[model samples]
Target: YTLMSFLFKLMEEGYELDLTYVTERIIAVSFPQDCFEETYLRNLRDVTRMLKSKHTDNYLVINLSERKQELTKMNPKTLDTGWPDFHAPPLDKICSICKAIENWLNADPLHVVVIHCRVRRNLKPPSQQHV
Candidate 1:
C-alpha cells in the first residue's frame, strides 16, 4: 500500500496527508478541509534544504472531488459471470478518463498531475501481475 503510506510521508514531511497513484501522471491526495495549519511547513523545515536540492519540473493538478457524485455514478450493467450485476465501467467513461490523462500529458512534457480525494486508500497493488 505505497499510496496509503504516502499519508505517512506527508505526515513525516510534516503535514498529515494521503495520496494514491492511479496510473501514469494521475495521483489522488487528501487534505484537511477546514484549514491548513502552518505546523506542517514547520515540520518540513529540517529537510527544506534537502528538498530544495532536487530540481524538478512543471506540473498541474486536477482534483475531481468537487465532482464526486458524477465521478462515482455508474450505469446499471449485466456481467457475464456467476457474480450478478457486476457492471463494468462504461466505455464513454473510460474514454473521458483517457482524455483527461491525455490533456494533462499535453499540458507539459515534464508536467505531472495529482488529484485530491476525500479519503485515504489505494486502488493499485505495488506491482503488476495481480500482486
Candidate 2:
C-alpha cells in the first residue's frame, strides 16, 4: 500500500499501538507531503494533534524529499558509507527531530509519533532517482 493509505489503515487498526510505545523516546521519519499544512494533514483523522518541534523541522522536511540541496553538499564518492543516500541528515537536524518525537510522546497516552520520509528510489523516474 502507499504511505498515506498505510497511515489511514494504522488509524483503523485501533491501538495496534500497544503500540507507539515500541521505543521509549524518539521515532524520526520523512515528511509525507505537507505534514504541517492544514488541508493535507487534516486527512489524518487518526492523529490527535500535530505540533512543530523546532525551527529545524523545516530543513528536515526538505532533506527528506528532493534531496538535491543536501546531496549537492556531499561528495558522491564518499556518500555510501554503508548508509543510504537519505541517511545523510546532519547531526543537528537529527537531534531536532529527536526533540520533536520526544515532545509528541509526552503529549498524551494515545499520542503516536508519526515521522516519515520517502526513502526508496525503486519506482521513481530516472530524474528523481538521485535528487
Candidate 3:
C-alpha cells in the first residue's frame, strides 16, 4: 500500500517514472511479514486492477523475482535505462499480476476495503518501529 501510494503520487505529479527504482524503494521499505496477510493481498489486487483499467497501454507486469533478476544482470550505469522496444513475438502476454487484478475486478465491486494488520513478516513491536 505504501508503495502503491507512492507510485500513484508520482504518476499524478507528471514525473517520468522509473518503475524499477520505484519497485526497489517499495521492497526496501516493506516488512516481510506483510506478504502473508489476506488484506494486503486484496489491496494489491485492487490497486493492480485499478491501474490496469486506467493504464492498460503503459503498464508492464512481470514477476517480481524475475524483474529483480533482470535488474541484477544489467550494468549499474544502465540501471536507469528502460526497454522501450525489445521485441520478442512470443513474449507479449498478460502477466500474472494483471491477471490476478482482472480476476478480482471481475468477481465483484470493490468498496469498504481495509487492511488493519502489520503486513510484514519482520514486524518489530510497534515501540521499536517508525514509519
Candidate 4:
C-alpha cells in the first residue's frame, strides 16, 4: 500500500474513546483521533481529561505509533517509540521499552504509564495479522 493509504487506514471509523487497563499501572488506548487535527482539539481535550482522571498527574506515556505528534503540549510527559503499527519493535528497542517502563513504575507507585498505537487497542484483528 502507498503511504497515503496506510495513513488513511490509521484513521479508523467510528472513532471513540476506549481505554483498556492492561495492568494496574499500565493502560492501553487507541490513538486520539489524528491528534494534530485542529477540528479534533475538543476531542483531544476530553481525552486528556479522561487520562488524567485515571491517575495522578505524575504519569508517563509510551507511544508505540510512529506518529509523534501530540496534543499541543497538553499531554503528560511522553516517550515516543517511533515504532510503526502492526509490527513489533526490534529486540534492542524491546529491551529499552521494558527498561523505560520499569524505571518509571519503580520511580513512584502513582506513576501511571499509558500505552497506545495507531490501531484500535494497539492490536490488529486476527484477520489483519498477516497484512
> Which model scores highest in lDDT?
4
TM-score of each: 0.38, 0.34, 0.26, 0.66
lDDT winner, 2 or 4 = 4
Each candidate: RMSD to true structure?
A: 13.0, 12.2, 16.8, 10.0
Identify the runs in model 3 with alpha carbons over 4 angstroms from their true place. Answer: 1-36, 66-131
Cα displacement (angstroms), candidate 4, residue 90, comes to 0.8
- By the TM-score metric, which is better: model 2 or model 3? 2
Candidate 4 has a TM-score of 0.66
lDDT, residue 54, candidate 3: 46
- Per-model lDDT: 0.41, 0.37, 0.34, 0.66
What ranking of all candidate models by TM-score puts the best one first?
Answer: 4, 1, 2, 3
Per-residue error (Å), model 3, residue 122: 2.9
Model 1, TM vs. native? 0.38
How do the residues 1-131 of candidate 4 rate in per-residue lDDT, one tens digit apiece? 34234334335543354556688788876654444465345444655666676564877878776766654266748888866544568999989989999999999998888786554355565677798
At residue 46, give the lDDT of candidate 1: 21
Candidate 2: tens digits of C-alpha lDDT, residues 11-118: 775322211323433334332342334422333322222212221122211123443332323212111112244447678766765676566557655454433333
Cα error, candidate 1, residue 107 (Å): 5.0
Error of 2 at 26 (Å): 7.9
